[model samples]
Target: MDVLTDLLQRSRARGAAFSHSTAHGAWGVRFPVGAQLAIHGILGGEAFAWTDDAGTSRHVLAGDIVLVRGSAEHFMAHSPGAETVSFLGHPSVGPPGGAQRMVFGEGPGSSTTFFCGAYTFVGDLCAGLLAGLPELTVVRPRSGSSLRATLDVFAGELLDDAPGQQALLDSLLDVVLVQALREQLAADVHAAPAWFRAMDDPTVGSALRAVHAEPARNWTVADLAAEASVSRAVLARRFTALLGVAPLAYVTDWRMALAREQLREGATSLAAIARSLGYASEFSFAAAFKRHHRMPPGRWRTASRRQAAGLASV
Candidate 1:
């Protein structure tokens, strides 16, 4: 798979708390800090979001989406200094087959209607995608951006309590998430992972996909260049410039990441894991894993499990 698709598939979150909320005069909502990511899209009126109680914040007009990356504690309001409330007692409704809604502020006044959602991720996931993102990302679409059109449909779906509404809303959220990520990935290509940044390069992107799709392949830079129909010198120069890593080095890192995941999740033998990642033997794989993770695979697995459990309970 390509880098964007790979990140999305691996980091696709679960048990998301999706809600459509309305705020009229004098309103604010505080989303406390946690690992779950918070996303907000303004459909009507406006809202401002900030990471701190007093810092420069992003103003969101209609057709704008904001991602509170890394789940930093944040506040959203029609105005910056509005009286805020916790979501604990917020009027929320999720009819059996309907989208969830939360309403606040006074009625019959200018209201900012928005959709907000949070998704839970396990195992300290999204290392490549989320690490490349900032503390907050606001997707302000220029013309021809898919995010704006999708927001319109997503907002309409939130209004009705129709059959299969929950499933529909979930699917729509996925679309919005992917679109936003794609936009960000495009804009932040230079700073993102090689798989993401290299996607625009016809030669480098094909090489990236080959490595991800078949981690077992004994891939050299020359092999990848052949796959991309480019010469070795051209591929090497372009790959290093665009992706910030040589092709073979990236392949080794990717292999180790896959091996680590298999070690953490599978009861399969070490030899199997090593063979799957194209290692000649378990001894070689263990030595590489030690270098990548600063610990042997067995110890890393134990420690990683403990850390994951700690994060889950927090």
Candidate 2:
């Protein structure tokens, strides 16, 4: 799909409250497969547990951003316990001592507490990226940094519980997810996929921006190379080196993504979408869509809508 749609599909939105006390000792929170990424920010007290996915666990504490890109089943608690729960446990235990989860560094004691959220990806490209990451990504806040302050604000807002509280929390979760993505991208050292690295190359980034900004344009290698102020060969070489795909192929994929999004939104007819994406005929557009997505545009739209509906029900 288009880059923006890819981001949304490979992401999910969720917010949760956690607590701990002497009676219950340790507990776990399980997350199902719908989310591609999850971020846990300590909101209050201290939270301790072995964060595990596929049986490997790491300890998490307050002021830590536990990022689970694999969306694996994991838990946070006061102690590591013998019993484990599936990702779909019901009416889970609240935090200890009847204390609601609170903002970290607020109220009284050094109790560990936090707010967590998860994001599931729906698009193919994003799903691939998520599949490539480790089970968990942890970001410890730097002292006196804006990220730390932002986390504090997030925890504070969560504690308020004002009107439209759920929606507000959802928005905060989005912010946390975006920040985590940005940090992960910056720290990633391995060879990344085209979309992830394209934004970092001057020439390729410019070309990508142009394509995304106007996928309807009649784009050619010559035109894009000229726009990037490079010879055709040099442009092609650099683009492929950085993005791992030829320029034309990338443009074609972007067009397909844009068309898929438009179709799913029911914003335009197939013919209109084809024309707007620079295709001369609806048949030509359908053929391209079939090649990329393995289905005709209409069928893909129906299937995608059905999948989204199923996720909502879950």
Candidate 3:
């Protein structure tokens, strides 16, 4: 898989806090910042998307899908001046695998309709990916675009309590979200992480997949190039050019990321973790970890556990 696909999968990104909101004249609903990401789709009449306290707004119309790239409060409204209701921490953020609907304007003339959902992503993978995106991203339909098709299906499934509807809606939402992300990143390739943009180089992409798939392996430029069917010098140049890091540095960073996860889990021996990450011994691993993380692995693990405990109590 390419780097973007691999990042999202490894992060365990999934939908949460879903809602199918319907409204009429003078309506607004605010989705507060807590979800890892949020998606707001305008399935019916025109509306306005209010993104921040600074009063920034974007006009959205029918068939438009907006992906909020990070955990920040945003809203949709019938007009820029509509009264707003907070959806965050509301009882409507319901049980697992189910959705809620909120109707506004309190009249039978519900002219506008939309569906919204928030995403929950685990792990550090989200940080690097979302950092490269603007706070708000909207997808306007174009002729013959598969994104519009997916959004259409998503819209139809809403308010329909047919059998297996939850599963179908989840699938459709994922498709539309992924397509919106792909389109946004494609529009501004520079907005994507360097590793994702690096796929333009076949050798770099191959090497990335190799390192990600078997991070425990002892990887060198020559070894990776041999696996990728490219010369050592070519691989080094291309890898550096695209990822802004040498191949070995990338491997070390990837390994340390894994080590951090293991540390967070707090369920394995330090030596075992080091070995799984391809270190010769725990001593060597600790030294390397200190050099990168600015603290010893054992101490880091302890601190992480303590912090988690504190949060759990809260």
Candidate 4:
């Protein structure tokens, strides 16, 4: 699997709470801080978007998309600093599969048609993909780009109340999420995470791909070097320099992340998780996990699940 695809799958990101609305002249909507990630697309007209503390807004024209990461309260409006109202539970913005139609301003004025959606992530593993993003990332739709084409189709689907429309929209939202991440991350290479940026390097990228493709394999420096067609010393130096960690160390970290997710879910036996992550036995996996997390795997799993339950109740 490629890096982004692997991260998305392992992180278990899911689409949630989609709504389509139109606003006319002098209108703003406040989105409460909740969703881990949110996306807004401008199908027609224009608007401005910014976080609560940003103090400035980004102008988004027709055929533009804005991505906001983290649990930051944000706003979208026809004009910057416009008076705002709570978006959640609004009459027009009902639950999934319901129609949404919002209106603002009494006069006949220019209207902005937009669609908004939220994404929920299961665990901190998602930080692998979302951690490096700024609070608000905007992308202008380029003519002939897949993102623009997909947005056009999404807009069309929003108008139809056909069967399976919800499922179709859900799938489209996933596509939009991936495409937006690919475009924005590529556009701002300097701000992207080292693992993502490293994927462009021929030697390091090849070795990384091999590791992700078969993470359960017992891999040595020489093994990964061969996959990249380079010497062990060369691959080690480059991988460390680019990722700030040795190749084998990165493998262990990734494996541990997967292990934690499985443990959190309270599914799969310890031995199964161990073997899947290339551990010789459950004992060895427990030892390594304890060394890294300062707690035994079983104890850590219990504590983590308890904490999750507490939070969910709140």
Candidate 5:
């Protein structure tokens, strides 16, 4: 799959959120690594996010999407002078008043509102995609952009106690993430990373879309070249230059990613999944999975399921 699709899948698997009001007297809040990807959307009032990068602090306002990508230790408070607090029961802290932290929940008050969630990425494609980002990514929606409108809608939905609101909130979180990535790609015009640069190229973007759309297809370099409407040699060179991998290799990686997701869900048996992914047999799929994840399909699935269960308990 393309990097964006891979990221979206990983995000969905490992993401959660909590929403509540910041206590009026609450001071600084510190988030530590492995704490999860936390995103705060201001509903009313304002606060600043402070980090120790070079002993400096960055300030954000309402309507901005503040992403602590690495779970780096950072604090949020009503003012810079507020006393910092440690996260209770963990390394980070929330505002006072014992506000109930809801993973992807709605707030009950008019305090400065925030949505906190975390995502854990898997596979080399996702790792490479995230490596290019800053430790903390704060995306401020441009004026009149669709991103702003989408965030506004998210805020409104969070405020609204509608039926099935949790599912709606989850979908809105995905939109917010996609829009943030789009904004990041649009604003970056320099010699960007391979994934971002690939998306910007018409040929590479078409090729990526085709691969993501039909990852199980028996794809050859020539097939991707034809899809991009370019000669085979040209397609190969451009694809490698922009994506840091050959066309067929990229397709293989994407197929493996899909298989990983399928295995985690226990959606089908190994043989069925292998067949659906165009593998010759369960044996071949197991060998490939072992090569990629250093374990056979069955073992990987068990481990992944266990890990997922542990996360759920948290």
Candidate 6:
């Protein structure tokens, strides 16, 4: 798998609830801040979207897609400064495959049609992937692009209550997310993190794919260099130059990322985690992890779980 795909999968990214809403005249809705990512697609009409903490607001027209990241309460409305009520429950109009529209401001005026989706992700690796994006990303669709096509289908699906509409909508939302992300990352190469942009380089990109594909493998600079059919010195220089870390250091970092996730999961034993990450023994893995994180693996796991539990209780 490519780096992006691997990151998405490993992070366990999944769609939460979704809704199709329409508003006439002056209307606004405030979305709570929780989802790791939120997708707003303007099916028809126009609206303004902005985060509460961030002053960035964009006037989005039909066929426009907005991607919001981070835990910031955000709003969408006919105007940027319009008053908003909490978009509580995002209740649908009917049952599954039923009319999924939520209406606001019944008075006669210009109508705005849009769909909103929330996505939740697990693990810090997901943060690495998202770190490349700005707080708000807006993309205007091309007339015949795949994202446009997917959005069209998504809008149509909401209108039709098919046998498996929920499953279908969920899947279609995933497609739209991937397409929008690809478009944004491609259009703004400099804004993307160096490791992601590095995926474009023939030399470094090849090595990165190899490392992501089998991070458990004992990778030497020569092993990675061989993946790109380049000299060790050449590969090391290019990899370090692009990613700000040597190839093997990148490997260790990735492994540690995996380790933290597994540790947080609290199911895998230390020996198994060590073996899966290519450590010769649990002791060796613990030693390496301590060096990287400045805490023993067991202590780190306990602390992480405690922190998570504390947050969950709140």
At residue 289, candidate 4 shows an lDDT of: 95
lDDT of each: 0.79, 0.64, 0.80, 0.86, 0.68, 0.87
lDDT of 1 by residue, 208-294 (tens): 888878879988888999989999999999988887788888888778767766776848688999999889999999999999888
Error of 1 at 267 (Å): 3.2
Alpha-carbon RMSD of each model: 2.3, 5.5, 2.9, 1.8, 5.9, 1.7
User: For candidate 4, lDDT tens digit of each residue in 1-314?
Assistant: 67888888877889853688888767889988878898888989988899987889999998888999856899998778888888887777434564466655445679998988888888788785777888898988566889999999998988888877778888898998889888888888998889889999999999999988998899999999999999999999999999999999999888888899999889888999999999999999999999889999999989998999899899
TM-score of each: 0.90, 0.74, 0.88, 0.95, 0.75, 0.95
| Position 223, candidate 3: lDDT | 91
Off by over 4 Å in 2: 1-6, 9-28, 31-34, 44-53, 69-71, 80-110, 121-125, 142-145, 262-268, 290-314
Stretches of candidate 6 above 4 Å error? 89-91, 97-99
| Model 1 lDDT, full chain set | 0.79
Q: How would you encode candidate 2's per-residue C-alpha lDDT over 221-291 as one tens digit per residue?
A: 99899878888998899988887789999889778766766776765899999999999999999999999
Choose 1 or 6, whichever is better by lDDT: 6
User: Candidate 4: minimum summed lDDT over ten consecutive residues — where?
Assistant: 93-102
Question: Per-residue lDDT for 1-314 in model 3, tens only?
Answer: 56677677777789742787778877778777777788888888888886775367888988888878665678778778577887664445333455677676655454787888777876676688787777887777577889888877787777666767677777777777788888777778877888877776678888998888888898888899987899999989889988888999999998898888888878889999989999999999999999999999999989988988897898
Ranking by lDDT: 6, 4, 3, 1, 5, 2
Off by over 4 Å in 1: 15-17, 188-191, 312-314
Error of 2 at 247 (Å): 0.6
Tens digits of per-residue lDDT, candidate 6, 73-186, equal: 888888887898788865558565544678876577899999888888887888866777777878886668899989889888888766888788888888988889888888
Q: In candidate 3, how many clashes are counted?
A: 0
The C-alpha local distance difference test score for the whole of candidate 4 amounts to 0.86
Pick by lDDT: 4 or 5, better one: 4
Weakest 10 consecutive residues, lDDT, candidate 2?
16-25
- Candidate 3, poorest ten consecutive residues by summed lDDT: 89-98
lDDT of 1 at 28: 86
